[model samples]
Target: VRAEAIITRESGGGRAFHALVSSDGRRIEADLLVLSCGVRPRTRLASDAGLRTSRGILVDDRLRSWSDPRIRAIGDVAHVADPRRYAHEREVPGGPAGLVGAGWRQAEWLAGALIAGEDPSPFAEDSPGIVLLKSRHVDLVQGGEIVPDPFAPGSGEVASWADPRHGTYVAMSTTNGVLDGFVAVGMPRAAAELSLLFQRRGELPSDRSLLLRLDAAEQPVRATGRDETVCICNAVTAGGIEDAVSDGCDTVDAVGCATRAGTGCGGCRARIAEMIDEWQGQHV
Candidate 1:
């Protein structure tokens, strides 16, 4: 429903109570609402800590605090600067992705940076954003750059398959034969398959029409390498799942129980299942 205006009050006013919209405009009604949310970047703590705070806590590409390298920031709390640049604006990274994947990537990088005592290479500034919506029988996944370089050498192609009734829209662009930008909606298998290609930055075949096919007749999006992550939440790798399958984890639930992979977020459950099938075929 496209809400043009929020009707907080009954047709006419004179109401003792009204529904409350959330930080992002979600309706919630109660006699006394205990609120704990903010749409704005919370910088009070950083300011109090004497850290330079702007739209967010300013941090270098390494995610180190501008004032103190010992302190690091990640996710929505920190504004990451472009690591490639070193100027007055060097400290100002572009807008934050504000996505879970962004934070997860930061956490993973931070873990490595702390151990190695070096900056996280290919940091979050340029990492693609993934949009996911999962439910019992519904699935949606979008990732990669939204706008591709139109004039770049060996420019990518844009393709899409949409179905409004099912609320499905899949649009993607590939540059120099690589799967780069894509938006997948209500296409679980296709989206899941395409995601791996996008993440891998893998090259597409000479005949790329199969990728845009909305039907099940479309070709598979290629297999996952053993080392690549199939489930980010549990840090489960494709090889790990293969080992589990070798020990007799046949179904998604079984694999989850064995490795605790899909128990969180459950975004990778489909991919996990796909890998299990691929593994079984190879073993057979």
Candidate 2:
């Protein structure tokens, strides 16, 4: 691995990239170049306004700025320093979650507290927020504290399976038979089931390897439950989509307009479409 090598320019041998010229005069040959420049939270406004800033505007569990309780922050800018269940006596930690769903949840809760005059409890995130890569060529889903050493003193039970030939991999960590963290690649069915189980904090079956069977060719795809969240970004459920379909929503867009299912992230659009077809078939 070239540590901290900065690419200055690209050289092409044919139609595509052939090599990268670095500042230190290193020519790194490559067939494909993927640029993955990450984002930084813009906290200048908060910092200039005198609110503490680190990675983002540091806020309490209530999302109120430590320096100014009247001033609140949310979305990509707010850094939650004091999370729920964390004692004040303990060191403050946490930062911007960088997830749209988390931001949506924060906004919804904050609106209720500010405008609706609701007694809002401490804002709690869906711990270890789910990440989905919405793409046709690749199916990847990850969530929770996945980096723990499985063999560590208290790392919990870890199970993994790989089929490199099929480009499928599954690895999960659980505590006391409960799913804690997982990463699934190239296995859509397993990813969906794992996501649901992670969200619900459900227990894994005794034979955890059963999850592998979800992607088998002979195994029929399981139907989602009515209560299962179809669009996590909007908290839209399968039943919600069914209701929309029953109300004459024929297309995915119509269902989205009716229930706001596929509007966020677009990862659940395929699922919404599937639900629409299933429900429409039932009606027919």
Candidate 3:
């Protein structure tokens, strides 16, 4: 499996793929092959057409190609090059976001611009994008600068814990007690709390160990903050959901349609439902 080079893949009759032949003449047979390599923008056609490209098709604030006004790029193939767009200190290098939420935002904006026939506000970057991986066997959530070296100059407190046997790990770094970087694996509750703190720029508990308790033995856990985000994909907060409910969005689907909260990934639907129930209980 660690062969230096995968020379060829052979397909047998009646099978989608039969075997992989390595440079060392080893033939590995498998029922499925999963390639986990990351993605790159497919700009070959644009490049052949003599369009400007750097990391992706170079675009301005309006998502129009710098080289060709007629050709616009969005989604993972756009590198928005507007220097004034990103004012944050931790801005990512200029390139395509390669994220579904970002793509949706771009599509919506572009559609509106085309329909109204007027220039809209420049598309903005969503810094510190949340990453979530949910599976039957593993759960992971990460955001921000997850690995600031504790020994580095100007770095803040860094705390970490790992339980490999239980497939659990948590690490966080704070800037003046504010959660700036974090990562969690296999600890869903802790991960959720960390995510909220990260979104709110909330201070971590003075005793970092308190977070471990949330995931330790899987005790009852809830992160209590309505101003913090719940639907990261749409940047919707618990407070936003409450407002929607107060505005007569009585059902989960109604809330989704009103705020576009649970429309993406659907990871926050249960929380949206819970918020609705809590609101109704209080009002009654």
TM-score of each: 0.62, 0.80, 0.66
lDDT per residue, candidate 1, 130-192, as tens digits? 556545555666676655445556555776667788677777777777888777777655665
Write one digit per residue (lDDT tens) for candidate 2, span 149-193. Answer: 668787789988888898898899988989989999998778877
Q: List the residue pairs that clash in candidate 2.
A: none
On the 0 to 100 scale, the lDDT of residue 223 in model 2 is 45
Candidate 3: clashing residue pairs, number: 0
Q: Model 1: which ten-residue window has the lowest total lDDT? A: 1-10
Name the regions of candidate 1 deviating beyond 4 angstroms.
1-41, 82-93, 116-127, 134-136, 146-156, 165-167, 212-237, 247-260, 270-284
Record all residue pairs in model 1 with backbone atoms less than 3 Å apart, i.e. clashing. Answer: 20-28, 22-26, 80-93, 81-93, 156-174, 156-175
The candidate scoring highest on lDDT is 2
How well is each residue in 1-284 modelled by candidate 3, as lDDT tens digits?
46443333445644365566776778787765655454599999999999877788888888988778787789889888863453332443678877667787788889998899976888776446777653335567888875556787766788999888888899898888999989888876687789888867889999998988877664633335666577767777777887899999999999999988888777777768777887888789
In order, how many clashes per candidate? Answer: 6, 0, 0
RMSD to true structure for each model, in Å: 8.0, 4.4, 7.0
